[model samples]
Target: MISGVTLLDYRERYSTKVYFQKRFFTVYIPFLFWSIFILFYSLILGRISISDLSFASIIDGIINSKFLSFYWFFMPLFAIYLSIPIISLIPKNKRKTIFEYIIGVFFVFNSFLPLVFNLLKIPYNSSLYIPVLGGYIIWIFIGYYLDRFDLNNKSRKIIYILGILGLLLQIVGTWFFSYQNGYVDQMFKGYNNLPSWLYSSAFFLFIKENYHKLNFKGILSKLISLCEKETFGVYLIQYYLMEFFILVLHFDPYSISYRLGASVLIFFLSVFIVKILHKIPIIQKLC
Candidate 1:
């Protein structure tokens, strides 16, 4: 028979392992859910409103916007807005060839963008993609460390504090110092400019604090999981739907309310659209 002390130790070890597994999903689920909503809108621009039709025109638009941007400052997320979710899919321990990793990072960073800038007449911030994707990748590495390594409380606290502080600095740099010209004001430069580091830090901590309390089983849980899965589909296509609203409603998308309205309304509608598309065989690939 097992000794009492050994049995208790085994039980504690098992509990800790179980908790780590749950925490991993907790961080991922919320990030993925929001990424879907943003991705839908990005795709709409690429699919429906593309007018420039050339890579040079897109680059020209970026330069032109910086100099003589006559349009009101409006920031809509690009599909790379889903970076946080995308990185979650990168397996932590999977090693890559040097060339493959470089290509992987490059491809991940530019997934929905090169097409958008090349095709769409719209010109937004150009360089903001770096920190958005970079910060997310960094967070994934951080998440891996927190989960995979044996870190003492002191080490965790130091990392947590430094991460928070660095993020604050990045936010300050984006808002008051660097980053401008209407590229998703959520990034390093724009109105309410904040760095990806700041945003990701807040997101990471928010899930860490709330994951346990969230019911991961039940009807609502399933609903949220569905939402998370739909993020990319919703993100890529929602903006196309919004373009419909833009043309028909004559809504001044420059206004904050309009953007938020676009984001909110597009989310559920895309969710419904995704569900319907899933039922069809041929269109499932598009979704």
Candidate 2:
């Protein structure tokens, strides 16, 4: 949804060159800086040995985002940013049809087909390949589509119902499979799955539709604005804060209260740290 807003903003206001430059400075540079910082932190914590630190290894880490596992999201996000020039070329008149077709193709091959194959115990041989329509890219198109078009009351109602069903399927199916298998199962929890897509889309639509109704004032508004501004930095540094909580503070992972408390504490701490970092001229841009 954020990416969709970005794409919309870019297409409506900025040139491709300008967008690319802004993305480079704001996103790419910060990603690079944070990846390296994580790498150094890992080394200090003995998660990685000094002997493993070489120029080639560092380059590999940056490219693969090995410093933090979830940081792999950056590669796809970067690719999406790079493809913006081509994606933005879709003429306004045909965008609705084209985007719908693209999203449909993606849903079938990437989500539905895989689920079908897995259920039927059929090995996928890659017989029919639709390379252009798959993965996180689908979300970008979905985001753009949702942003560009408005759904009627009937359509919104149907989508909301399906989304609720999707959410139930995700939660119940995972629990059932896990219980049967005597282990945790993540089969239904992937973002690329049908359930995830439906749930996410519905949630995005709900927020978009109702955003104006939510009016915050005074300290609450200021705090929300501050957190929003520092979100990127918080995301970048959150892993370390989590590690600090778990390893240093010895927070009980199994305790629900501890988990909830830790989450709130980590978020505020990360925001505070990022806010402080922003005050330093040299470090501000990197974050």
Candidate 3:
């Protein structure tokens, strides 16, 4: 939704070059800085040694760090920002065709192609040029297309019903996959899975349709303002915060009580950490 709004503004008010350039500086530059921070944090903890710290190692950390696993999202985000201009070029009339094409490509590359390759014992890179062609591409396109119009009452009702049904399917599908595998299976947890894709689309549509009805005042409004501004930073760092809670404090992995307590602690800690980071003049950009 945010991307769609930004893209619409770019199309109406800014030159393509300016839009792309701003994204590179605003998005990629911060990502690069935080990625470096993650790498150095790993090194400080002896996750890697001086012998492992070659120029290639640094490049690899920037490209592929095992310790900072959440950084994996950055590659796709960078790719998406770069591709936005081209994606936005499709004529309004042709959007439906483009949306359908993207959905078809997702199924072909993410679902069907993988099955074919595995059965044939073929090897391939699964990242698919990072975010540009990954499973989340469908959601990106769907959000963009949905942002172009206001859904009617009937359409909203349909989407809401589908959303609930999809959520149920997602839960059941995850359990089924886990049972079949005799372990926890993440096939349904990802954005690319059919159940997740459907659920996410419907949920977003429901939100977009009803967003106007939500009213926040006083403390709620203030909290929302802070979250809207700082959620991206929170996202970038929350994984590490949770890890810290688990590793340092020894939060019980199996106890629901411990998990709930740790989650709340992690969230508030993350908010405080980001707030402090944002106060630093130089680090503010990265935050």
Q: Indicate which candidate wins on lDDT.
A: 2
- In order, how many clashes per candidate? 11, 0, 1
TM-score against truth, every candidate = 0.45, 0.92, 0.81
Candidate 1 vs candidate 2: the lDDT winner is 2
Backbone clashes in candidate 2 total 0
Candidate 3: deviation at residue 258, Å?
Answer: 5.1
lDDT of 3 by residue, 1-287 (tens): 45754574477678998897888766788888878877778778887787877887788878874557778877766666766778778787888777767766776767555544643768746765234465344556777767776667887777778778768876986789789889987655666655666677787776666565654445545667767667778878898877776788787767896677877777777888888988999888876
List of clashing residue pairs for candidate 3? 76-131
Q: Candidate order by TM-score, highest to lowest?
A: 2, 3, 1
Model 3 regions more than 4 Å off? 93-135, 214-220, 253-255, 258-261
Model 1, range 68-119, lDDT digits (tens) per residue?
2321121122122233344334453452333245434544444334434533
Q: lDDT by residue for model 2 over 132-196, one digit each (tens)? A: 85447778888877777998999899889988998998899889989999988877878888889
Highest TM-score against the true fold, candidate: 2
* Candidate 2, residue 205: how far the Cα is off, in Å: 0.4
Q: Candidate order by lDDT, highest to lowest? A: 2, 3, 1
